[model samples]
Target: MSTTTTEVLAFPNIKAIINDNGTAEVVVAGNSRVVPVGETLQDLRDNALALVVAEAKTLQRPVRVRIEDPEGHGELIVHPDGKVESVSYETRPARHRTAAPASTPAAAAVEASDSAAEDVAPADDEAAQQAVAADAPVTRRSLKETSFLVSAPVLEPATQGWRGALTRLGFRMNPSAEELSEREDIRTVSQHWPGPRTIAVVNRKGGANKTPTVVMLSAILARYSGAATVAWDNNESQGTLGWRTEKGAHDRSVLDLIDSSTELLSPSTNAAEIAKFVHHQTADKFDVLRSDENEEGDHEVTAEEVDIAHQVLTRYYRLVIMDSGNTARAANWRRMIDHTNQLVVPVTAIEDRAEAARLTLQTLESRGGHDAELARNAVVIVSESTDAKRSMTGDALKRAKAEAQRIADGFEPFVRSVVRIPYDPALVNGPIRYEALQPATQRAWLAAAAAVAKGF
Candidate 1:
C-alpha cells in the first residue's frame, strides 16, 4: 500500500506557484509541501502557517516543522525544490485514538454509563444512513448553502435586464404594479412593476414548520427556475431559521446593509454581494439571507427600500424568496404579505380538522385577499407524518395517509391544491440538493414553485 505524507513548513511570505503545466504548487515561507498525485494531503500545515504569521505580527521568529514517511511510501518533501531549508518533527500525543482498549467489565461499564449515546444511536444512525443514502459523495460543500446564477438566452428590449432574467426563470409578476406612479421608471418589464415583490412567510404561531418551508421552497425556485433566491430572515425575535440552516452569523444581516449604505444610497444589493451574505449550498441549490443575530436594525427597510431592492434585483435575480417572520410581532411581515403573489400554508397531518388549519384559512378569508380565491394560488401541503427523517410503518404510515385527506377536506373551498411532503428531517437538517429529494417530495415543491411563479 502506498502511504501519503504531508509536512507543514513556515516561511515569511507564502505564495501559490502556478506552473507552466497549469499545476498549482505552493511555497511556504522558506519551505515547500509537495503532494503526489492520487494522494490526499490535509492543509493542517495551513494552521501552523497561520500561527507563524501571528507570531511574526509581533516581530517573532518563524515556526519550525518536520515530517516523516518511513518507507518514502508517498514522497512529499517540505523542500521538493530545495527552496525551504530544513526542519524537525517532535513527538506529540496523537490527535485520534490509535486503538480501542481491551474489553473489560470496567471498560464496558464506562462505555455503557452514558445512556444518551446508546439511546440516540438508532435514531441518529437511521438519520445518518438516510442522509448518506444518495449515491453522491458526501462532501461538506455539498451540504453548505449556496446562491443561484440566473441566465437568459436573450434580453428583451422592453424588459429590464433583471426583470427579463426573472421572468425567464419562472416567476410571476403581480398586478399591483399598475397603481405605481406613472412617473416611476418604466421600461419593458421594469416599467410594469415599480416596487419590490417582497414576500414574507409569516405564521407567528411556531410549529407552523415555517423555516423548512422557506428553505426548501427557495431551494426549489433557485435550482429549477435558475433564478437568484434570497431568504430575508425577518424573524427578529430569536431568529431560528438561521440556526436550522447553519448560518449563525450577523455578517449578512439587514443591519449590515443598513450600516454600510448611506441615506442617499442604500447599498446596491447585487447577486455577488447578496451571495456573500448568503450561505450558498449548490447541493441545496439556494442562498439563506440570515436574520439579525442580536438586535433587529432600528431602521426597518421601508417600502421604497424594498422597491429599490426589487428594482436592483430586476437587474440580477428573477426570484426573491423572503422567509418572513411567523409571528405578528414582526412589523415587516405585513409589508411582505402586501407584495406576495400567493400565500402558501403548510399544515401537518393533524386529527382535529379545526385545530390545525382553521386559523390559517380564517386569516386569509379575513383579509379578503384574492390569495384566498386563487385556490390554485394558495398551496396546502399535508405532511404524511410528523418526523419525515424516520420511517413510518404500520399504523403510523396508514394514519398519516388518512390524516392528509382529512386535512385537505377541512380546508376545501380555500385551498387549490393539497400537496404532500413526507416527514424527512434530513430535508430539514442535512444538505438537501434538488436531486436528493424523494421523487414525490420534489414534485410537490415544483408544483408549489409553479404556483409561486404564477404570483411572481
Candidate 2:
C-alpha cells in the first residue's frame, strides 16, 4: 500500500510518506495534507503554481520530480497541474526471430486452409481463447488515459475547414470541427479491454447527477465502442438508472440476476441467458441492472452479492458503469469502488452537491492505499444544477460558468480532469435520451464521456 515517491529526493524540497491506508503525508514548506499516493506531487505543484512561475521570472531553476511505478515508469514533468503531460519510452529490443525456410506451394496452401478454419471457431473455443487473452500482460502506463486508435489515410489538411470542404467535393472524408472531435471521442471509447473495466459514478449527495452521468457515459460507450456495456444500479435499496434508461420486456432486477447467477455462471448456461435479468435500452444499445424496489425489505445489497453480480456482468460486458446510492460507507458503495478501474465523480453547480463530491474525494484519499490511485485519477464532472433556475438568464449563465470554474479549480488539485457540463433543459429531469439532448448538451456529455473513456 506504500508508494515510494521521490526515489531520489535531493531536490524539489518535497517528501511523501504513504500510509497503509493509501494516502501519504505530503510535506512542502512546512505544510502537509493527507493525499492519495499519486497526488502528493500534484499538491506540491498546486501550492507552488505561482511561486514556481515567479521563481523562473526571478531567474531561478524550477523544481522537478522523477516518478516510477510497477508498470513501466515515467517522470512527473513539473507542470503546475501535475497531470501526466508526456511520457518518454525506451523501445524494447526486437525479438530475435528465426526466419522460416521458404515454404513449398503445397505447404503454404495447407497453412492458409488452417488459418481460415481458425476464424470461425465454435463458441466454446472462442470463450477459451478469450479466457487465455485475459491473462496477457497489459503494458499501458499508469496514471495515463487508455486510448485505442484507428488510423486512416489523410489527404487535405484538417485545419481551416479544408478537410470539410474536400468532403463536400467528394474527395476525402476526413472529419473536421465537431465531426473531428466526435471521431476522436469514438477512438477513446472504442478500446478493447481484455477484462471488464467498471466506472463508478458516485457522490454522497442524491442530486449530484450521478445517474444521468452514468447513463450518458454508458450510452456513449455502447453506441461507439462496438462492445457490450451495462449500467448497474448497485444501491442497497432502490436506484433510478434503470428508471431513466429505456424500459425493456423484462422487469427483473439485480436480485433476479443474483438468484439466477449460479446457473448463469455455469459454463453450460446459454451465453444469452444473462439478458433475462438485464433491461436493454433501445437507442443507447446498452443494458441496465435495476435495484431492488421493495422499500421495507431486509435485503440490502452486500459486497459479496455485488461481487457475484459483477462476475455475471463481466462475462457479457466490456464496460460496466455503476450508479451508486448516497451512502459512501455502505458495503455496496465501497465494493463498487473496490471493483472500479476508473472513478467518475458527478456533481452539480450547486454548493451542497459540490461539497459532497469534494468530501468523497477527500475520504478516498484519507482511506488511502489502492483507493488513492482511484481518487487521484478520478474524473470530476460538474453539471449545472437542475433546480428552478431553468437554464438561467444571460447574467445567471455567466454566474453559473463562474461557479463551474470554481468547482473545477477546487477539483484540479485532486482529480485527473474536470469537465463542466452545460445546462440543458432537456436533461433537467426525467428520462435522458442521448439523441434528444440539445446539440451543445450532447457535445458536452460527449466530452465528459470521452474523458471517462480515457481512464478505461
Clashes of each: 26, 5
User: What is residue 60's positional error in candidate 2, in angstroms?
Assistant: 28
lDDT of the structure predicted as candidate 2: 0.73
Superposed Cα deviation of residue 450, candidate 1 (Å): 2.6
lDDT of 1 by residue, 179-267 (tens): 12111212211212333344445454556566777777777666555556666666543466666664533366555544443431445
Name the 10 consecutive residues with the lowest summed lDDT in model 2: 53-62
How close is every model to the real structure, measured as TM-score? Answer: 0.49, 0.65
Q: Please give the TM-score that candidate 2 achieves against the real structure.
A: 0.65
- Overall lDDT per candidate, in order of appearance: 0.49, 0.73
Best by TM-score: 2
**TM-score of model 1 relative to the true fold?**
0.49
Clashes by residue pair, model 2: 21-368, 21-369, 22-368, 22-369, 23-368
Estimate, for each residue in 416-440, the C-alpha lDDT of model 2 and write its tens digit.
9899888877776678889988878
